[model samples]
Target: MSGNRSQVIIQSKRPPLSSAAPVKVTTPSSVNYHFTRQCNYKCGFCFHTAITSFVLPIEEAKRGLRLLKEAGMKKINFSGGEPFLQQKGAFLGELVQYCKQELQLPSVSIVSNGSMIKEAWFQKYGEFVDILAISCDSFDEQTNQTIGRAQRGKSHVENLYKIQSWCKKYRVAFKINSVINTFNVHEDMTENITGLNPVRWKVFQCLLIEGENTGENSLREAEKFVITDQEFQDFLDRHQSIKCLVPESNQKMRFLDCRAGRKDPSKSILDVGVQEAIKFSGFDEKMFFKRGGKYVWSKADMKLSW
Candidate 1:
């Protein structure tokens, strides 16, 4: 639900940052592995099929995770309907612990809808995680309800702040992922997102999948949410003052292989090896790395003293 909420242009008297020491680029970048499809919210524009099912067993899931590391993926982001929705993140924590402690992946992260996350869970496993990305589409409650992201009687914005504080306390880099669609494309989130100051604000255009979110047999209630590329850009233009803005139009989003069933079909790491699966899926390797898909922005790696 997070859009590139804001952008800040810092005008300084000092020299430009390009004069600083060169950054070491991590090779064999990252991949988004949709470990589960069980999510709480039923957003109309969502392209991922919402399922009340769990596929891989714990041990088998871990084996697949290790295979992904062996395939040269430095960062493995666990995504789903919501990664934190399972048993108060018990099963999710085990996977996170395994990736960081056993497989030793450089970056381990998750994309979640912040409602089910607890402070206790963060205290136990937060150190092992690199980033916690919350999907927050709108700051307005009515808009959220219209978009199907309401947290029952609770407020999503409130949960976001609480989660942000928890992330700060546990030293996990916080990120925001927003999908811009018709409902929220015109909303200005500068004041709210600027206050949060997340490390990254990933904004994506709303997309329609052939059989998943659209078409005759699909859950296509999201046609009302689709926005044109120009309209999406207009929204970004309105929030140019917010920092850490990374905008992805539908064209760019299509090239990201991790987005299940986008341009190429999704393949499970358990079914085929990571390399073979990515190869078969036609993931844009060079583009993926170039888009800052993998960076040394992990709070554990940076040790920011906030």
Candidate 2:
């Protein structure tokens, strides 16, 4: 493989797809692809923990994305361990360009810890990415450290501001995702969040996922981060004045329902195609729409002045 653009491809062995037709076909209007399960941050309450370091070959990944686009996928959110960590953001930049320029998808976005993103990455891939959702659990520096969101020699808050500025400079819609836990549930982030002025501020309640954050197979012990539903609601009530605030708790927001306490591994879309693989995704289509999953996702139609 080429050195300049190729990522470390650790392919997972999979069984062959069945020839039988699927009973139902789920139109994947929006999908999240956790391309790599490796991250630099040690966030205690992360549901999608670093269980494996495997990332499919760049060509195969692009092929899978093409399949999704052909299968009615409108929006594709590239998430990680950290999407930028692979090949120092080159891997992600290529995928973003493919989804927007080649596939002509309406929306291509990424969810990342702001630390790894640099101004140069934005310069190259900013136009392709509709939204950049940075994970910021707390405004307080000390609180962030307690939540394992702090990097050793860097200030998470400062990096957040720098990224916010870059987003504005590049005309990318900036967004924030905060997981309200015991560390930040009582803290009022009204002033800081409002000052940043994100197009959307997604406030999520700390959730537990078996084999990821909870149970025996988990990498992180997130029980300490858990809070009651009432606490989450109180936090929302406090931030009610923030017009862009979008609150999502365990009950209301989930692309896939793993309430059964164990998530069964499903075949890769590359192996079974998007139609068969999506059936086992446990995606809740109704709840996805109810929680305002769909909106003006395309940056082209957003009509924002750069």
Candidate 3:
């Protein structure tokens, strides 16, 4: 989509696609464990099939926390249909607070659809999160409504600007996340978002996951927004500070990986770590570090990092 005459997107040349194929190897992931499903937005990008609504039981999460620490994972992120939906929105604030104060995890992040966000939630628990990735596909209200974010007030641009104000006030990491497809491909991306927030924008290539209510159809509409792998690398280079990582799989896609080298044949670094943390909520933070193993990013292409 060409932007209004002389827009940066129109003037900017897109990069080419890379030859890298999705490889299959299991290595310890540096950004380790994620919380169970629990989100509010019926996001087109979620693999949960528009269903993020549940925190892992306390017993389960405690063990999961321990395993994550042992693996030497640098960051722990919380994502769900809407992670804030734990205990029906009321507990959202408490969940985040506990994650930071009690778990004491070094780095924690949350990806929200932002349709159900409340002002008070941010003012109170803003510090609990290290990064807040908000899903904002376009500036057009009609376009956003088509993609299932009807709850947002007025227009996408308005809500985004207001949300940015909150982020700035809290001094929290505020990233603008989007899965570009046809509907939003034409909007003024670099202009609309970059004008206000610099180096915090993230553009994601839409994944073709089946089963989700608005996945394939949305992707089809946003097809023009589809940039090949090389184009993505170029986009990141052009917008150097945005901190983008385009997985070959695109989203939390499931693929066959048998080389994780778990000590127990059935155990995976992700599985063992999350499971161990959930085992003992009573365990001390120090003990979790000792028992939870290092998270190994065992990729089909690269050897173990830790």
Candidate 4:
């Protein structure tokens, strides 16, 4: 296995297809590959802030993705500190292109903050990505800033609209991931959420990992973002009018068989292989699919022109 390193390249063209064939997995329906935990935002409630570094080399990442593809993994969502934080989004685009064109993975998607994305990236690699899940915690600017999701000089809410428009133009399924924290738990986002018209709205109860987002090693102990279950429910009740709402409570998120809740030290498939890596993380297929992980909009399920 190659050493983990960062490669910052502006991709004028896609990388050549690796002759190495894909290794398939038959058990899991989908996998959330937190490929890079290097994020631009310092949101206090972030669960995956355990690592602040990008470790896997591009070749290693591609190999691991191919392995997952061969493993019969139907869908894969690339998450990060921020997936689009790389140069010209070239690093992320290369991986997406490989999944769609080489491995031929049915669904290849990204979870981003929507602050750093550009129209040029969508125009170039839009066809490769099936969905773009953006994180927007609140419709209120002050509330967003207080939650540490505020972009300098740029409006996060405004960026949401811009990205939504780009998604419509590029034919990528748009989704919103909002963590209902104490900061914005009561902020009524119904008007803004409804107007945006996301294909899915994933609302998460603010979560805390033992040492990742809490304890000594964390970037910022996220006690401030913590909200009670009743508070979370109240927030949900306020937005019940939204068309596509998917709620995941903290109990369901942390205690139940949830795929995205586990905060074990993430390892590359190069080190542990795909199965052991997933098994080590406790990814539950039932919970994953139950949360609409294998939706039709994913995996090349384009409703618009590619």
Model 2 off-target regions past 4 Å? 1-24
Per-candidate TM-scores read 0.85, 0.91, 0.60, 0.85
Q: For all the candidates, what are their Cα RMSDs to the real structure?
A: 8.6, 5.9, 14.0, 7.3
Please identify which of the two predictions, 1 or 2, would achieve the higher TM-score against the true structure.
2
> What range of 10 consecutive residues in model 4 has the weakest lDDT sum?
6-15
Query: Residue by residue across 1-306, what tens digits does model 3's lDDT show?
Result: 001110000001112335673532221233323344444455444444323223455555545445544444345555555655565445546555665687665555667766666778777888776667777877777887777655756565676777777766775666677766556544555566655562245566565433332334332223333556565455445545433322232422222111221110223324434333223222123322332222221121222121
lDDT for position 137 in model 3: 75
Best-first order by lDDT: 2, 4, 1, 3
> Candidate 2 has what TM-score?
0.91
Candidate-wise lDDT, in order: 0.73, 0.81, 0.47, 0.73
Candidate 2 residues 123-209, lDDT tens each? 999989999999999888999999999898789999999999999999899999999999999998988998999989999888887
Return the lDDT, model 2, position 270: 69
Q: For candidate 1, write residues 164-206 as lDDT tens digits.
A: 9999998899999999998899999999889999888999899
Query: What lDDT does candidate 1 reach at residue 103?
Result: 82
Best by lDDT: 2
Q: What TM-score quantifies how close candidate 4 is to the native fold? A: 0.85
Candidate 3: residue 135 Cα off by (Å): 0.6
